[model samples]
Target: MATFAELPDSVLLEVFSYLPVRDRIRISRVCHRWKRLVDDRWLWRHVDLTVYTMRPKVMWHLLRRYMATRLYSLRMGGYLFSGSKAPQLSSALMRALGQKCPNLQRLCLHVADLTTVPIASLPRTLKTLELHSCEISMLWLRKEQDCSVLPLLECIVLDRVPAFQDEHLQGLTRFRALRSLVLGGTYRVTETGLDAGLQELSYLQRLEVLGCTLSADSTLLAVSRHLRDVRKLRLTVRGLSAPGLAVLEGMPALESLCLLGPLVTPEMPSPEEILASCLAMPKLRVLELQGLGWEGQEPEKLLSRGLPHCMVIVRACPKESMDWWM
Candidate 1:
């Protein structure tokens, strides 16, 4: 019986890739064969920054030589930049990655701080980018690059980042092929940013804005209306009102909708209000609500209106509505 260690490199890598990057790296530490194959350029093809403990310079040197052609995707967590030497580390890593990973297709950076990114250093082949709570200026996306065509580009997830300006959003218009966009953060992102991005993205199909404090009832209402073609929408904030619920009523094509927030305020609307507002969405196939309840109110009315075809998830949601919202 061959132990995992005895498996051929080809067989081992196929199995290794299925494990999380962390697990694969852990396995690599056990013995020479595993480590050798794990460090193989093909195995390191899509590096997840979460798994590596090497110094930034070491990672740069490794990529420049061993993993250059193999790398196409990079997913990094916020902790990668939490080190005291992050400024020096990140700058070197970015420069090295930009130079070495020319065929890179997807880049996910979840760094929570930074006012600007070295946009000029990014590879032109990048097609998918996800930034979670990163300090990325829209100006960098707008003014820094010379490439006009990103044909394979599709998804951009900017979750809870605070680096957006109207002019910065206008720059996203350059990506004619962009489709899915997820923007959620504590930033004071205006409806204008959404409007600007959506209007220019002729092929956009999914849009999400979580924790945005859109100006007023009218502007908030105008949000769902503006992203008329968006088939999936997620809007989460502290307090949602009647008018905010009303805006969702008009999203005819929305198949997946998530309305989430902490149920910790006097201003928080009842679950019934959200359900009633969204009851008319004929095509809604998925509904997710987090922290769904009022202080002392029953959600029976909201439960009764639940759509049977929809895959409902009410997490931290009241148990009473499980049968209906399930």
Candidate 2:
């Protein structure tokens, strides 16, 4: 039988890769050979610092020591209670990331304020950026940079961000390479902003707009006319009539659609009419309806009227508390 110490360095490194960051750090103190293997740059390619409550100085030291150039995907920020001082620390860490990790492709910041960070300080190589419940300033979006800020960005998710508004959408038109966008719980963006901003992004393919007050006539009409290449769309319909929902008929390439929120009001069209309008689409493949308030109607019977080629799902909202997206 072979002893553990006689194993090759590659084998040891593979084992260390499966361990969490904290566990790897602890085991790095076991021996000189283990420490060397644990500190290898390949093992630090994806760094997640959200698990610990680290001070600014300690985070800086860790970045400088371990995450200089090999980092590819980074997820930071769990400082929810550190209100006033969080932005400064986040800015420092972001600056360090821009300087050290030029190859980073994906970055997710949860509850980190990004007001003070300069736009130029973000890595130009990033393809996906997810800002969950972070405070952002209008200046951060509109600030002029040297053409390198978010030039190659493909996907951006702004989840429950209060500061995101129509101006931010207008500012995003500079990124012509953007393909996928999610505006969940951004209540400030209106139909005019959505229409004007979306018309400029001719390359956008996937879109999701939830927890916002949007109209099917103005907003969905713009989506139908402008986003001709869209493949998947998720939205919340508040008070759209059956005819208003017909705006989706203009999207020739739409494949999957998700409709959420209270879509069955007395003033709007009936569930049967809405389902008929959806089935009229040429290429629609998947349809999901959730959280609809049809108190007296049988939604299953309404949806079962001969959509043999398409997949349809009709369900009520769950009684238990769950994630907003669910």
Candidate 3:
């Protein structure tokens, strides 16, 4: 067997690829050639620092040493930061990401304070962005003058952001290339802003809006008018009426739809109307109803009878709590 020193550069780099960023950084100190080989661009293509909450200083050290232009995907759990210091660290990190990792495509951040993070520092090539339980100060998202930042982004997931509102949704309209968007815990967005914002995203193919108070008819009308190509849709509706269910006929391309709310009662839309709407959808194959307790007879059986081509599922929510945390 060959010794560590006798191993070829390709063999050494391949071994380092499987190691965590911390371990790779540690092993890079073993020898002069190992230190040089560890900096190879291919070795840093995909970096996930989410396993542990990273320290700011250590994150800075790694950014300076290992993050490179070849890095494609990065997921960093939020740093435990507070007050004035947090913005400085975020700005510095974003600047390094902009300056070094020009090819970064997907970025995920959890529990981050996004008050001072600059949109300009985000790489122009980025295609996907996900922010979970992040603190985004009220209207801070709409304050940016550059509306087209991340213009190429195709997907965005904003979860558990209570401060996100109509103006923030309006700001997102600039991403004309957006194909898929998910919004959870955004309770402040209403029909007016939701309609205006979605009208601009004509390319949207998939959309999910939960914990918002929009009526079902208005939401479906907007989707039918603006997002004609939407193949999948999921939204929590309020005060869904019988005639409102007929709006599904306008969306011929929809393949999957999920309706969610407290419960589907006799007070809500009638089962016959819903069944008729299900049969009208041309390409629909999957229909999911969650947290909706049917009144007399379950809508599932009625829909299955009308739509032999569609799969109908009805589920009671695991818990009554709509808490968006975690």
TM-score (C-alpha, index-matched) for candidate 2: 0.79
Q: Can you rank all candidates by TM-score, best first?
A: 2, 3, 1
Which candidate has the highest lDDT of all?
3
Candidate 2, 24: how far from true, in Å? Answer: 3.6
**lDDT value, residue 137 of candidate 3:** 58
The regions of model 2 sitting more than 4 angstroms off are 1-20, 29-45, 78-80, 85-87, 90-92, 143-146, 262-264, 267-271, 293-305, 314-326
Q: Please list the Cα RMSD from the true structure of every candidate, rounded to 1 decimal place.
A: 5.8, 4.4, 5.3
Candidate 3 matches the true fold with a TM-score of 0.75
- Name the weakest run of 10 consecutive residues (lDDT summed) in model 1: 317-326
In the predicted model 2, the residue pairs found to clash are none
lDDT of 1 by residue, 195-293 (tens): 665566646688666555653343446556566777886665445676666777867677887765553355555666667766777788888776655
lDDT score of residue 164 within candidate 2: 87
Worst 10 residues of 2 by lDDT: 317-326
TM-score of each: 0.74, 0.79, 0.75
Q: lDDT per residue, candidate 2, 19-85, as tens digits?
A: 8777888998999998898789999988887776677787777778887788889888757667655
**Clash-forming residue pairs, model 1:** 160-184, 160-185
Task: Sort every candidate by lDDT, greatest first.
Answer: 3, 2, 1
Q: Which is the better candidate, 1 or 3, if ranked by lDDT?
A: 3
